[model samples]
Every structure is written in structure tokens, then in C-alpha cells.
Target: MKRSSPANLGAEKGQKQPTMEEDKVRSLFNSKIWDPEFQDTLKNEIAMSKPYNWGTIRDLIDDDLLRKVRKEIETEIHFTNKETDIYKVNQSGDLANLSGLDWNDLSRLPSLCRLREILYSEVYRDVISHVSGAGTLSGSKMDMSINTYTKGCHLLTHDDVIGSRRVSFILYLPEPGKRWKDHYGGGLRLFPSIVANVPHSDHSAKLVPQFNQIAFFKVQPGFSFHDVEEVHVNKHRLSIQGWYHIPQEGEKGYIPGEEAEWVKTNTSTLAQLESNVLQDYEFPKNERNILPYHQIRHFDELLAAQTSEHEATESSVDLSLLSEGELKYLAEFISPHHLTSAGIHKLQSQFVTKSQLQIDDFLNDTKSEVLKKLIKTDELQKECPYESVNVEAPWKTALPPHKWRYLYIDGKSHENFQTEQDILNSLNNEEMPNYNLLSKTLDPVKNNTETELISVATFLESTAFKKFLALVTLLSPLSEQVLIRRFRPGKDFTLATQINKNDLLERVKGFVEAVLEGTLCLTPTDGWESGEVGGYELYMDNQDDDDEANTDIKDAAVYRSDDTGDSVLINKPPSWNSFNLVLRDESVLQFVKYVSWAAKSSRWDITAQWDVKTVDDDSENDAE
Candidate 1:
């Protein structure tokens, strides 16, 4: 590749002083006025800058000297787009082990050493000291390589509020003497402050470089937002980027723990922390399905009782609820293709109607035989559907009364609950009749039976019941491919208040949105309404409830009759659980697929997967 020199458009010359140190400081570094005071002044001047605005001194390095350094780096260095980090790098040359590389390694590359010498010369030292207002002059290190942003390349806005970095600098390297034309692209665009803490959408300061120009800025967290304008032509716009970390010990103004102190004070959100360069690989492993600390402890305490293999064996069979015959019946009903319309109609009439379906009748049906066969073939039937437990030969869930209560019971702290009277008081609380009834259903304490019964009715009116309906839809025998688990009020749920009805409903909506975005393959057209659920037009009559109500269980199951399509248990199929498990283990694949599909540029593809309908008159024509 042909080497290019750093750009220095509209270079201004500063007079060299009599003393050698003064000469270097005056010409090689930015002027004293443009250091800290200039930054503060610019912060105030740029109304576009947010409250946390800061800028670096431009023209710090001599243009002639910088051009030479840029040429050397461009010719000698190698580059690779990390396939890992979002950035690219030349790791094997002078910048090898850059994060831990010593500053002295620049000697290996003569041009880089020369560049450093000019950067930290005595004159520059005074300028830096005056601008930074720091007493110490520690060794400066350059670790990154020249990056070329060509056609279609772009970076989003973000603050460089990472650990210990005090200042950031980039030296542009394009063809020397050739004006990096405005239309040719590749300009350093600086954001203007919008408020104290945010930046404007459009750029306020643009540095279009010639050869040997250098741009520097203070590393202001949460305020600095800049991007390199993408090059439209095939030409490369290269730049050497690096950071100046906080001063080391023995340097003036270097506090022993200042770096650590700053980091401790600026806490990142879980989302930002996961994006750290060093922590990216470990993030998914640590984050996926991560239960809160309390939930983990609760599970640990509950599991502590099973000390022996005998206890584990005893916990598998649930004779009281689902016996051998019931398991056999379940296996039959769960077949992917076995239950067609006729079987569905027969089963709904023979067993499901009147809510009089006995477990024996459900088990004896021919469809039940399908479920039985599945249970017999499968070796890993979990007890708590929410939890995975091991079984030896026949997969069964133990239905021991306390074990049942332990897994399904809803128990939370109540202020007054020490003795029998306390328990009675909790049952009598006007706010807790439903909870009291469920408590009675599990243990059926002799006292306060009437209040508990009334509480059961209250429970039926709750949103949790609706959530349970949705979960049952997921776990139904006909759709074993779909996995569902309840977000228990105080246990499985997070990110929202467990007991807040509105919050819980919002969570359900979010879950629906995520599934639609990720798994449901959609076919979209323009006429679709914003929240349309089904793929195409729905001939739903906007009549009274009586018109919509089904006369019986079979009627309710027939969601629509015009389309002879088998009533789909789900709107569409979700990604296989096995595939998701693989993805959870392999982050690289997950990221590639996720970025390709979930990125803003490809959001339309996701919308298409859900079969989003269009509102246009021709939308009906398109569906056909």
C-alpha cells in the first residue's frame, strides 16, 4: 500500500523562541491559551455542546514533522479489522500488546520514536502543564495503529468515559499536499453541546485535514460525541489514534489512587459494563438468565435438604397428580402432527367441556395414548417445570405434598406472621383474600377456612391468572416445542415491580415484542396497523360480546372458520430451543446473527418475519 502523510490544512506558524525549550514549546505544541482555558471557553461558546462539553487543542504538533511520522506509520504498520472488537488494529508491530506495551518500544520504529520526541519535548511539556494544570510530566505512550475509514464506514456516537484516560488525540494521514476534499469525505466531525449532558445531532466543528494536522480533545465522559465522515470514493482516510492516561506516581498532581477513585465514582449501567472490551466474552455467560442474588440464595437453601441420591430418586415420581397412565397419555397428545381438526374436536367434546374432564378420562382417550408414548420415550421429565431435576429410568415428577408446596407455593414476607393468630391476621387482611386461598389450597390449614375460600375468588380476578393462561398456552401438550416459565412475583421477575399489575402487563408486552422481533418469521406489507397480531387481514366482526362468545369449548377453539387452516396454537413458530442454547454458548455467531437481523438498518426484515399486515386497500390482494 502507498504511504500517505498526515494532513495539516490551513497551518499557522508560531515563532520559535530564543531558548531551545521555549522554541519547541512555542512551535511544536498548542499555545498555552488554547489549553484548559481555551477548552472551557469553547465549552461556553458552543451552545450546541451539552453541559459536560470539553475540547482538545488543535495544531499541537508541527505540521512538517507530523507528515513524516504519518508516512512512516502508514508504510510500515499492518492492520486488521478485529472480527472481535468493533475497531481495527495493527497489533504485532510497535503497538503489539498495546494495552500492556511499554512506551519505550517506539524506538523499534524510528518514525514513531521521532514523533514521540517532538510530542513530549520540553516546550510541549510547559504547554501541556499550563493547559492540563497538572504539575507532573510523565512518559507518553502511543499504542494504536493507523485506521482507514473508506466508503460505507461509519461509527455511532459515544463518550470515551473509559478508565483512567485523560485526553484523546488523532493524527490524520491522507495523501500529503492533496486537500482532503469536502465531497471526497473523511472529515473529523465534532459534536456541539445541546445541554449540560448531551450533544447536538448535527456536527458543530469539522476538521478537514491536509497533511500533518493533529486534533486533540479532553476525554470528557458522557459529553464527547464525534464520528468520522465516511469516505465515498475508494481512497482511504487513515489516522493514528491514541489516548493519554492519567499521570503515574512521582509525576506532579499524581494522586496514589486518583485513577481508581475516578473509576469508582463513575458507575456504568449493566448494559455499558457488558460492552467493555475486556469483558465482552464473559458477558453472556455471566448475564444470561442471571437470577438475582436473593433468588440464588433461596434456591440454594431449598436444595440443601437433598443430601443423598435416595432423596433425589424419591423426588421424581408424582403418583398423586400424574401417574404412569397419565404420562403415557401426555406423550400421545404432544405429537406435532397427530392431533388434527377431528381429533381436536373429539377431545374438546369428550374431555374438556363443562370443566368436568377427569384425569382418568383424559388419560384413557386415543389422543392421550400419544402423550403416553412421548413420556415413555423421554428420559428427562422435570418436576418443577420451572426447574430441572434428574430422573433415572422412568421420567416422573414427585408429587409429595410439601414438595408441591415448596415449588408451587406463593410465600412472601408479611409483617404479622409469627404464630397461628398472625397467620389468621394475614388471611383476614382485606387486601390478601386470593393469596390466603392459594395458601390454603397448598397446605389447607384448619383455621380461617372461610376467608381462604373467598381469597381464591379474588385470585381468579388477578392479572397473574392471565399470565398463567399465556404460560399454559406455551406449555400445552400439542406444542412441546415451545417452552414457557412463569415470572414469579418475587422470584423469577425483575426489571419491574412484581406486584404492580400495570408493570407486569407491560413486561408481558415486552416479551411479546421480543419474540415477534426475534423468532416469529413475518411477512409484512404497508397496510398493517401498528399492533396487529396476525399476519394478514382478520375478518373479525366488531359486534357485541355475545356475537364473539363461543357456545362451547369446541366453538372457542375454532378461532376462525373461513380459513380451513388448522387452528395454529401459536401465531408462528419460535426459534428452536436447541438453537438458542447453542447461541448462548457461542457468542460470535449470536452477535453476527443478531447484528445482521436486529440492527436498525435491518429492522424491516424483522417486521417481515411476523407477517405484519398493511392497511392499504391492496393489502388484501398482497396477502392472497
Candidate 2:
């Protein structure tokens, strides 16, 4: 680790310097004051505390000093949207960019620099150690200062507890004269959990800061649900926000090679973490469709006309596959504002029937509201029971995580549902006004070509694609969205369509062709029951069983394996690279009708059949 000189510590040197009194308070922060009285107070005052209001060293920096810093930042700073592996530079949500702003111009911002030092200081280490007692934070180094939230800027509620985050802290830097008003918005909001895994919005913790005040909290996993209220006022809510990473030598929390060791541990890959989240939504552990990696070989297999069939005993986990009761329960929890009595009446008719007579009607509607209600409710349900299918051909599970990922439309990939509004705004501001129509040009030959290309672009720009993008954004480690617009006269169009649909039919054909050309990456094996320790398999501990025999069932082995070979190979879960049926114009029309029907039916098994075009068989192949 590198060290900055004392002189480089900046303008707030006086405040950063601890006095004897400050030292005593620091000692208290370091101590384990876990007595019953203290514990109860903490619980009442802080633990179960609603809308917490704790801030640190509020007036650590003087106004004149801050003004100078703001001037320097305003002139010399050049903020761009912050980019990350999970989130891209949001065009609509993000406008100002000071991340690339040179720190040299920020010298006058004494409060900013001072906050950083204290955060990376011994004081912070002691405070966190006392609060969390989670040993010391470790892993990814926090190197940059992201100062990019302005009016209307907000971040939705999510735990900052990504792999190995030690502590989360924010420093305030609103304009000098005006108070950082709550109405001006952009205040930090924290949510209280109904249970360890479930959170309710009934109560909240808001942090509206004054100049130089800093707020810190340990990164509590599944808890610590926080978001930035959208700045309502016209002014920018400037803040020097950062994190105090786990110990690094020469730094306050430094431990010997501790950071590197933790990084090597690979607590959980981004993909695995995503899998865990999706698992929360009705996807059973073992039976979930675990697709292959996004490799060329798998791509080829998808293009062939073969199905995947592995011999293993079916799982017995009674997941809420399609229960109308479960759907009603979820409607209460995250219910859409547009709910209507008509929709409820519709749902009641089908849900109450539960009779096999309406099974066909139930499986015929796969509309947005229906899917949304079903999936969202399923998401609220923590455990996914095993499901069995009697369909023909290659049999596999369609695990949510395995299928959803960053999906690209036009040139952009959407990873979360929240991003669609931003995407539409970007398109309107940058190019098109409305996506319903296309901009026409006047060159007979060129015009025709451009018109077709624009249609493709328009299709990519469609609301469906935007919704698809949002759906995939929440899929996992590949959370970042990216877009690259290109016009392919004839050849480009074919390839784009093919690439957009990277599913079994396409992959199988591609694989078969490659095999004939002697480029097959084949590793054949008899599928194992519970896959080998490292292979793609589900290891489930019985969670719901209450009886003693069920307790044994909990320990009983439940595994679903893809291959049973002596050769050790890595197994990659599936990707929805080319599994988009919703993108088709016909699909969209049918989808709307299905949703309308679903609002009334509230039934889950809304199945539809489409002919999958195979490589050898140009004719459509059908199976349910």
C-alpha cells in the first residue's frame, strides 16, 4: 500500500488531529461496551432505531474553506458517469461527472479530504470493529472518489454488501449556504428488515446531512438496505462518498497480506451471488436448468436439433409452481399501483376454481402483469421446491438465474428493470423522440436499406427490448449494460438475429456443424444423481421437513448432475443469450392478450407452443 505525506492530508489538518478528549472517545469506540444496559440502549436507540439520525463530526470544516474547495472543484473538476462491472454510466439518472475531476483542483475542499482520512484512519477502524465485530474488512481496494449525485439523482434500496465489503460511509457536501433540506431530497434512506431475509418499508432511517458531517455504518448483509432519495431541488447535492476497505499494510486497517488472501478466497463469484438471489424466486436448487457457459461450443450445440436429457431421480421440493393463493399473497407485498378491481375479479374466477377444467385456460395466459405477479410473488418466496416435467425431447430446467443476464437491444444491454426508463430518456434526448415510429430518409436504394436497418434499430429500441434489458440487468455478475449500434446490410442482419437467439435449437445445430468439421469440444459422461462435488449439481439440505424421517431427508443427498465423467471439468450455468421469445412482434401481441387474460385467471401454468426451427429440419419442430 502507498502512503500520502502529512502535508498532502489537506486543509482540515487541524480537525483530523485528535485532541486528548477526542482520544478518550476514540478509545470508547474501540472497546466492546456490550453490557446489558448499553446493549438495550443501543437496541432501543440504534439497533431497532427507526429512521436513524447519527452523523459524525458535523462541522468539521468551516464554510469559507468549503466554498474555496467547491470553486476549485467547479472549475477544475470533470465528472463523468461512474462505471462499474455491475452498473453502467446511466444517461438519464446521471448527468454530472466529477469522478475524473482532478484531486489537485479539490485542495480547498478540506472537509472532503478530512473525511477521507478519518474514514481510512485508525478512528474508523476502531468504530467499525466495535459496531460489527466482524473481524476486519478485506478484499477489493477502494481507490476512487465517486462524486456524481445531483438533483433527481437517486439509488434504489439495495444492500451494499457485495462480496467482502467492510464498511459503508458517506460524507456530505451540499452547497455552503442552504441547509441540505430533506425536501431538497437526496437524503440517505435505510430500511428495517421484517426478518433477516425480508425487509419492510413501514419504517425508515433517513440521513440528511449538513456541511462536513459524515455518516458511517457497517456493511450488514441482507440488512443495511439503503437508497438515495432523488434530489428534488434544482441544486446539486455534492458529497465525497467512499469506503474504508479492509486492512492493507501501512494503512489504518492493514493486516499482513490480508487483503490479497481474502481476494483469493473468491467468497462468491458474481454469477453465484446472482444465482442465490434468483433462487429466492421459486427456482428449485437442484432441478433448476443449469445451462452451459457462453462458449462457442455451447453456441454450436444450441444451433443443432438435439435435446438435453440426463438420467436422474426427480426432486420432491413442493415449490409454488403456480399457486393463485401465492399470487394473491405477493400482490399485497410489492403490489403495482395500477391494480384494478377488474384484475382482482379476474384472478378470483380462475384461482378459486383450482379445478382441472380451467387448467388449459390457466396455462394459456403468459402476459406481463400475470408473469410479473407470478414471478414477483415467487421471488418473495424464499425456497424453490423440485419440479417434474413430462414434456418430450431434451429435458432441462429453466432456472431463472441461468436464463437471465445482461441482454442487449439496439446497442445497449439492460441488467435491471429500473434501467428502462433511463434507456428511453437517453434515446429521446440523444436521437428519437418516440419509438413507435421511425425517421424516414429519401434515397430510393439507400432509403430502402436504411428503412430496414432503422426497423431493426426500432425493434431493438422497442419497449419490449427495454423491458427485457431491465429483466436481465438483475440477473447477476454481468449486471453492467452496454450498447453498440451497427447496421448490417444483409449479412449483418442475419448474424444479429442469430446472435440474439443463443438457445438450444441454435446451439445444437452450431455444435453439430462444428463436430462435422472436427471442432467439437465434447466431454461425454453419464449424468450423476447429485453431480460430483465440483460438477454442476444441486446440494440441498431439507429445509421444510419437520418429521424425524424428514430430518434424515434434510441430510439425504439431492443432486442433479449433467455429466458423470472421471475427467474434471468446469460447469457453467446457462445464459439467455439467445432465448428471447418475447422480442418477436407476434410474441409481443400474444403477450399482451395473455396478460389481459391472466389478470382475470390468476392461473400459473400458462403454457404456449411454438415451432423451434432446427438446423437440419427447416420445418418447425413442436413440443410442450
Candidate 3:
């Protein structure tokens, strides 16, 4: 064989030399990115950051290459809108896994592949490792997804603590030259931690994104709570979301139990107080603890005074056309239809048949208009202080925000418990704050002009209203609780679940819950159709496997999706002058979906509950 030159020998083995163009493409990242001084500065910034260790880099990549990459993504990728409990956004189903794609696939998206290669190159990986102090991230285990948040899209709070993730990042690619305004609202909001696993209610820091900028942080489990604020207006916030994982077996920093330890420390679970203080905080506490005999007798005497015993025993109680005095009190808030005989008959018949009633225009037009205007003004003009420490008297933030968050007039006492220990102590002391006092206190503060919310609550708690409820449900109310609530836009919600039942309260037939809601939808933008932006109240039949065996099964609040044939009774949105009444037997699950920041206004309502007595069907049949 002829003696071959070195180049000829390499060609014989099918090896190709790197071209000048390939070398230039590989160096698409900023040269200064690899400088030691730059890396140290980034590291220091992350170390000193508040809420958690995080940092941002502007113009992280070569300007021309990033622009080309953005063009490729916009033209070549298909995106689909995804919605779940955790987030809502448009996402590209095509994952950025370069190693898995064949040459044929790579050829179709050359710029994207090049961008991915440069981002995961060893030099960049080392830079990220040094800055995050995450130690030897796995370059081979690339994880990234492209997402677009248009108007109304949001990602709820969550800590990126799952699996072997060491760092998380997002690279923004909005319109190339236009600046994204703060009012547009798609900011990365970081939350402070209250304890090991609990995050504070409000976000402490927000980073408004820009084209060619990247925000990143060490994924510190519970300490890294963050969320994407809803995009407030019509615009697209495109980004590439990715994570750097801990080193694999052959890579550096592959500690065997590090991931497991992180999971153990950051796993989602109820706080100690949530499990132990149910009776003290939740409604219908000790449901079996019937109203005292004297109290029931007192209500009975009131009913007897209104109607003769013979008239009360008739199939229908004459609740229509209340005395002029009672009607006048009710007319202040109640709709004329509800005060009429025909309306009461219609509602009573419906409640008897379905155990639920929804009354539209529940409040008179005049009252509804005034309340709506007042609520709209307050929601628009008043700043809602979310944390309990910031809330003023007459308006208190609901406690243990892990369960719910809102401002409410509980009408009893004001007890602001700042710590979990304080809550536990109060529970142990059996302290029950009376919301009635809160209502009274609010009256004087509003200059004796009781807020429309207070007026509604007052009417609901009045003995006449209770009698009206009794007539509709054919039950005798023994005791009741009323709450005037303001579910702040973007900050309040109650998760899907059931009422808490007391074994002692099981002796009574059931309880009644009524919500008179007026939505002050002030969302400057539309698209809150169906339940997309949430804020809807939902009710479902409780699916308890051992319901029959359990004495208080009807009062049990537990719910499961897998239970066969469970069904929903109602799903209604917040409306002006609407009233919903549900007769719960301990087996109904209900919840208010989290109101989105996109909502125009707060969800204002009067909520009330009554423990009532029901005649046993068997005893009634025997007497008949």
C-alpha cells in the first residue's frame, strides 16, 4: 500500500476535522461568561440574596445567536395551553432533549440544537456550578421546556424541590426591542419562608423579565418558594424553563442520599396546627353538640308566637308576606321575590326536593346596587393588607393561611396569633372569638353607617331570617354563626373539602349553609369564562366508603375522587345579589376556587351556618 499522509489516514478512518464555522458556532456564548471574576461576582450575589440564593444575568448569550434561536423557536415549535392546579400556561410539547433526537430531527432545528449544546457545554456547566455552589451539575442530564404566558396565565406558588434538581432558571424572550412593563404583571415573585416548610403569604421580591435575560437560583426546597404572577394584559411572555440536576454516578457531586434528604425536608404535608386545631378553627365544630335545650325552646317559643301550633303543623308554613315590620327589615337587603309567597313556595319546594337552592337577585335591586358600588369602590381604592400584622381592626386576615386566606368579620373577638405555637396555645385554652363583637365594632368605625356586608350578615342572623330558613328547610334552627367575608382578588380561596363534624352533633339531622355572594369583578381584561380564572364555588356529594358504619358519616368532610359514582350538585360563579343555600348532612364537599389576580374585584359575601333539628322519618311515619 502506498504510504498515506496523516490527513489521508484520518479520512480513511471516516473522521472529519472541525470547520471554522463550527468553531464559531460553538463559541456563541459571551466570552466574559467564563471569566473567573464574573463567576465570583455571581456567586457572591446568590449567596447574599434574600428569600433564597438566586441571581440574574443580563445578555447571557451572544446577541445574534439568541435572536436567531428565538426566531427558530417561534417559527418551528408548536405550543399548547395547559391548565392544572399548579399552573396555567402555553407549553411546547417538544422537550429540549438534544441527545434523543436523530440527525433527521436535528437538521430541522439547527439553531435550537446549537443553543442547547452551548448552554450545556462543560464550560457553562462549570460556571453555573461555581455560581450556585451546587457542585458539579450533570451536563448530560439536560432538562428544559419552553413556555409562553399570555394574558391571564399564571403559575401558583411552589418550591422546585423535586428529585435531583440543584438549580432552576428561566431565560426570557419577549418582543426583541420593546420593554416589558411592571403593570403587565408576569414577574418572577419570590416568597419568604415562615418556617421549615411554610412560606409567608406575600411575595417579598419580584423580578420583571426582559428579552435576553436569565433569572436563576439554587433550588433550596422549602426555601425556594416562587410563583409567576399572572400576565395582566394582552401580551406573550415567552421563556425557556430548565433545571440543573445533581451529578449522576460518574459525574461530580453525586451524593447518594442528598436527594432523599431534600425530599424528606421539603415534602408537602399539613402543619402540626392544621391537624390538631380542627375543632377550634373549622366550622360546625362539635356538630353533635346540639343546641342547649333552653336555646331550642327559646327559638320554639318565637315560632309559636308567630304562628298557631295548628298552622305550623301544616305541610307548608306561611312564611310568605312577613309582618310589615319584618318585611321592612328584610327589604333592606332581601329581594322582593324572596319576600313574596310565590317565591317562598318555589324555594321551599326546591329545597325539599334537592336539598339545595340558588336564588338570583336574592337582594332587592336597590340594596344590591348600593352594596355592589360600595364593594367595587373599596376593592379599587383600598389597599388590602394581606398579612395579619398589617390588617387593621374590623378586618382580619384568616389564620393558618395554608388552609385559606381572606379578610372577614367573624363578629366575635379579634385574636391575632402570629406563630404556630400561639395558635396551638389558643386552641388548648379553648378560646372562641365571637364574630358578633367584630360586627358591632365595625358599625362604630364606619361612622354608624353599617357596611352593606354587615347589614346582610345582620339580616341573616336575625331571628326572622332564621325562621324563614326554617320554613324553607322544614327544620328548627337551634344555634347559628354568621361571617361577612371578603375574598381578596388573587389572594384568597378555600380548597375543596367537607364540613368538620363533631360526634356529639351527629344526633341532630344536619345543618344549613348559605352564602349571599356579590362579586366585584373589576378585571380590566376579559377571559374569565367558565372556571378558567377560578373564583367559582363548587359542591359535590361526599364519597365516604364507611359512611354507613360511621355515626357521624353524614357530617364527615372527607372526599375522594376514586369513590364510585360521586357527583357534583352545583358549580356557581360569584354574581351580584345571588344566594346559595345547601343542606349538608355531613357528607357534602364544598370549596371556593382560588380567585385569580386577573379578577376585576374581590369576592364579597355573607356566609352563615345553622345547626338544626329534624324529625326522624320513622317516628313521623308511626305517628301518621
Q: Please rank every candidate by TM-score, starting with the best.
A: 3, 1, 2
Task: Residues 60-134, candidate 1: write the lDDT tens digits.
Answer: 566666776666666765544321102112222334223332334555455555555555444554444444443
Which candidate leads the pack in lDDT? Answer: 3
Evaluate candidate 2 by giving its C-alpha RMSD to the native, one decimal.
22.9
In model 2, which regions exceed 4 Å deviation?
1-44, 47-57, 60-68, 81-115, 123-144, 162-164, 193-203, 250-273, 282-612, 615-624
Stretches of candidate 1 off by over 4 Å are 1-60, 83-108, 125-145, 189-210, 268-517, 520-603, 607-624
Instruction: Give all candidates' CA lDDT scores.
Output: 0.33, 0.32, 0.62
lDDT of 2 by residue, 1-624 (tens): 000100011121112232234444344332333244643444344443453322244554444555655665566556644211111112211112222234444344443443343444454455445554445642224322446465434443455543345566666777776787767767777766543323333225677877666666765544565656555556777666555456545444567866556544433222233334423321111111112234222222322212121012111111122135533433332223212333332332332242111111111122223434433343344222222122111112221211211111222211121223432443354331221233232343423322332333343333232222222211111111112221111001000000112233333421211000000011112221221111111111112223332121111101111122222112221111111111121111010000110011111211111212222222122111
lDDT of 1: 0.33
**Candidate 3, 217-267: lDDT as tens digits:** 987755687878888888999898777776655556667876567655544
Q: Score candidate 2 by lDDT.
A: 0.32
